[model samples]
Target: MLISNIEVIPGKRITDHLGLVQGSTVRAKHAGKDLMAGLKNIFGGELQGYTELLQESRQEAVDRMIVQAQAIGANAIINVRFSTSAIAAGASEILAYGTAVRLNDR
Candidate 1:
């Protein structure tokens, strides 16, 4: 299914609105990675571990969102968005949401 951050996809028309679709995943930080991140913090460098984790989470969430859209018979998802939040002391949740729709060719 097609997904876009824009409210509308150029050259495509929204033929049907299938309401809101969303997917989320919760992940915990690894102790070893956290330690490495802490060390990097001193030098103000990128935390590769967390970066990888978030990237994976984002993809997972987006995949789930696509599943939901497919279930609803949607051909595309518009106004896609992602959100991150701390679910617990060591866990974080990533959410993907969008409006499911049936698209018509131009």
Candidate 2:
């Protein structure tokens, strides 16, 4: 399905509004990675482990949101947005959301 952050696709018209769809996932830092991150924080360097972890989590949330859109017969998702929130000391939740819609060639 076509997914874009804009309200409309250049070559397509919105045929139906299927409503909002969202997905979220929570993840915690593993102890080994958390230790490494702590050292990196002190040394002021990029935390590669955490970066990769969050990237993966974000993709998973997007995939889930797409699944929901497909289930409701949406061919595209517009105005896509993402959010991240700390759920606990070492855990965070990532959310992906968008307006599900049917699109047809203009």
> TM-score winner among the candidates?
2
For residues 13-53, write the lDDT of model 2, one tens digit per residue. Answer: 99999999998999998899999988998899889998899
Candidate 1 lDDT over residue span 1-106, tens digit each: 8889999899988889999999999999999999998899899978889999999989999999999999989999999989999979989999999999999998
C-alpha local distance difference test of each model: 0.93, 0.95
Candidate 1 TM-score versus the reference: 0.95
- For candidate 1, the per-residue lDDT at 71 reads 94
Q: Over 4 Å off in model 2, which ranges? A: none
